[model samples]
Target: MQNNKSAARQYVCKRRSDKMKITVRVKPNAKKDHIEAEREGEYIAQIKAAPAEGKANNALIKLLAAHFDIARSRIKIISGFSSRNKIIEIIYTRKQ
Candidate 1:
């Protein structure tokens, strides 16, 4: 029983690690809000909000969540919180 529990924990950890990381180049204060896939694991986001008081970041998160069809909470800014270029992590579980 102990071994089974340990194996289950390991499996959960491994499953949680099955997430995707992407690089995003954000353009704040654009005319429109949109997201374009530059290549695999890279994106260009044009946001309408200005880069002030985390508004642009929040807008970016909303846009990405809509594009990916996931909750905004599932997306995290792993780096570059104060820059245009940011690294984002998306947590998702594979549907089976």
Candidate 2:
């Protein structure tokens, strides 16, 4: 049989070396706040913040940091700063 597990492991290792991009779809002013991973590299974030004064953005970074178990400083909003659809960057450095 083909060693697919090893190949998959290698793929994950490569991903850790590269900057991971997460495409987020935000719904601000939601009744409740939550984060969902719709699919790989895609997320849906329902924020209670009113999308004002960068509060929503801050919430997003905080949520992502907790989900990825990384520091807030490592996650950045690379684009779509003022839009519902935003691109978030996460730096993953695998501890080998």
Best lDDT goes to which candidate?
Answer: 1
Q: Where does candidate 2 have its weakest 10-residue lDDT segment?
A: 5-14
Residue 25 accuracy (lDDT) in model 1: 82
**Over the stretch 1-96, how does candidate 1's per-residue lDDT look in tens digits?**
011122211111112465888878899999999998765667779999999999999999999999999999999998889999888989986787
TM-score per candidate:
0.80, 0.79
Residue 67 CA error for candidate 1 (Å)? Answer: 0.4
lDDT by residue for model 2 over 1-96, one digit each (tens)?
A: 112222221111114464787778899999877888665566778998889999999988988898889999988898889998888889977787
Q: Residue 80 of model 2: what lDDT?
A: 85
Off by over 4 Å in 1: 1-17
Error of 2 at 5 (Å): 27
Clashes of each: 0, 0
Query: How far out, in Å, is residue 21 in model 2?
Result: 0.4
